[model samples]
Target: MKDWPGPVSTCWNHWIAVPTGDQAGVMEVLSLSSPTPITFAEAQEVIDADAHGNPDDRHHLSRVFVTPEVDSWTLVIGAWCNPCDSERHEDVLRLCKALSARYGGAQAYYYGEQGDGSAWLVAEHGSVVRRYAATGELDDELLTLGDPLPQEQARRLELGLPADGDPQAASSEQIEEWTWAAFHLAPEIAAAYGVSPFTLTREAKVRGTGVLALTPDAASHGI
Candidate 1:
């Protein structure tokens, strides 16, 4: 109801997108529990508290926030989006498969707030079709999987690089040039798929509050 979270409630550090308005089904795939009716402001508080840390609790980071149906997609937000700090790409791929298996399609996106690192993943029927990420550190890329999306290929061609060329093998000059294009593609590609997480309020709203839920790992550990 009350004007769904949005463009300004934005600063989305990480999130997962699935093409369905069914939070219940999305929750099932994510293995979430205890759907507390939370406003966008309240959801932000949970994310903040997790980031702030708790003195007496060791598993404070396991909590995740879910968004109301923005356009036709439900966004599951938390550390899960970054796959536990992106230490393993397999975790990201697995999450994509899990969500896509039931949702028809799924996308995982992480737009690094503290750095230029950004990543986007696409999967259908439990298989990854495209993945791209640049850590913005000493290397040009931290991970790359499957093939480039149509938009990615076109962008690369526009930049004078081969549409299917390996960004990992780019020169320092090509790296600087193309990396700029890659990091910005996260939101652009999201817009193409369905909802750009940042501009949520711009889309039509159906009347439900977002929620704070226990992630699968947290629930398994009884945290």
Candidate 2:
């Protein structure tokens, strides 16, 4: 086992994590095109370049990068690869299902600091196991799937949320509190499910290599 120098902030906003070292398999599942192996340094360069108007049609509309193998997990990063950006739980479940079909399991997370929102979804063997999201801008549940994860259940209990979310029985302040709990849970939820990319520290074991790839959606358009 070896320690990573540190984690970069680019992945803090959105990322999909599949528990596997097979970067090719993850890229294949994503339908990514023209993958070129690159170090984390080069991966950061690709992201930075795309941000400053790299003017390369090769990436089409977005750039997606895969992280070097981190222990048993490989992370995929891109704004287009998120539920927070879409504000759609279905997108998270769909992508997780696709990745899980090939990788056995997948976890997707999103955190929008400006929006003060966060979302997380877990899928396994082609089925979504759980999903949750909150932006604090809606009264209705933005999204909730399956059941609460153990850590979530514990958090809810600690915060006094009942096992059954009966809004009818709760007061306005209580509802607001619960809604607040929903935001900013990506890190905790991710920690419980798998690796939390942004917080990865020296203790994490990394191997193989990462890469930059053109997204399939963009590449298919002949860019």
Candidate 3:
């Protein structure tokens, strides 16, 4: 395997199951639209490697996997980001829109910061039914539409730690401990939340506290 340069910031993993009949069509569409040309086997390999090599940074790999499903298809995309830039945030949104347009029922998860963030988006026929964001500390509105702001369930999960035990809590070590834990646990809960595990992990670190507590729009979207 080749070693990547620079501080690893973002990673993504996605899986989609299509009908055997549509397998060829799905591959063609993904190949044509994606910024990079990746084969099904290659994508799987990347996921496996990232999952094992650095489970913590699995979102940075930006990997996607597709397979054969029943009638239509199922898609899953995962991502991770560094948590400082905004351009990376936009790239993730663009990728989601493109894939959702190609497949009927699609879902996406974005993680990480602005410039070095990672994201994943996938669909079966042509519509996006689910979306998730794990990016730590950055803006939540960048990934979703409308108001109401999303809630960071991943963050909540992390905060679930014993209030006094959490480093961010009054009796804890740091104020951001709860947030960091959230980002770390994001990948583990990605499937349940339909969001990027990596992004959630990063968001935990920078999420604010106190009277100005910010909630992820996803939280209000009904989880």
Candidate 4:
């Protein structure tokens, strides 16, 4: 994570922390805050009514929205599990890398473990960000506005996966399977928008270029 200089504003204020099991209710609050008063049951109905079908949709509903207090505006998503843990950390890292490469750096932000066992990635361009952990906190400073994954780390991320596979190699069914696993393993954030899961997996390969294409330029050695 890139270090901020001084007393940054508080972005945590815009974040609405919901209980582990209250994701549906929270989403309802967000969705139904208009003229109509939506009750918990009504919100569940709307979620269930989606055409894609809900196969345990509850797991995909965990998340909070953060509005930053400083110049570098951002929304931070906390990781539900320890990012260093072999289980889902790699997936989180991969997604951040792809997002950074696609957006040209500083467009997204991610933090792993440090302050808390939380990892969050933000894509400010879309006005949509996802958080998975219960303890993730938001900083007040919105200093940089591009890729949060540094050049060095981005280079490593670009080399971590294969780039020559078939574009249609992973079928939707296969992708769905991985999505299900991701939702279950980290049941604190919603992984899908429509039929797509927010996090990318080996099987899905949603971000096109693959590992090699995303890598940064080699450093020049000075004599």
Predictions in order: lDDT: 0.72, 0.70, 0.36, 0.26
| Model 1, residue pairs in steric clash | none
Is candidate 2 or 4 superior in TM-score? 2
On the 0 to 100 scale, the lDDT of residue 191 in model 4 is 22
Q: Which stretches of candidate 2 lie over 4 Å from their true place?
A: 1-5, 10-12, 45-61, 87-92, 137-142, 220-223
- Superposed Cα deviation of residue 73, candidate 2 (Å): 0.6
* Shift of residue 223 alpha carbon in model 3, Å: 40
> Poorest 10 consecutive residues of model 4 by lDDT?
208-217
lDDT of 1 by residue, 1-223 (tens): 4645664223436678888889898888767888888877777766656655652463544667888777677887776566325443577678779889888999887776555567888999989888777656543344667888988888888877778967566667875777787767777787888776566664466446688888766765568
In the range 1-223, model 3's lDDT, one tens digit per residue, is 2211111223333333232335445445444223243433444455546544644432433434333222233333332221113534444444444555654334444343332233333333454433334345366435544211123433444445443233243435333554454344334434443423223232222211101111122133332
The number of the candidate with the highest TM-score is: 1
Candidate 2 lDDT over 100-197, as tens digits, reads 98889998887765546778788899998877777654632546778877766776676677755556776788777777777767778877778776
Q: Where does candidate 3 stray beyond 4 Å?
A: 1-21, 28-65, 70-91, 101-104, 110-178, 193-223
How well does each candidate superpose onto the true structure, as a TM-score?
A: 0.83, 0.82, 0.37, 0.23
Name the better of 1 and 3 by lDDT.
1
Instruction: Give the TM-score ranking, best first.
Output: 1, 2, 3, 4
Candidate topping lDDT: 1
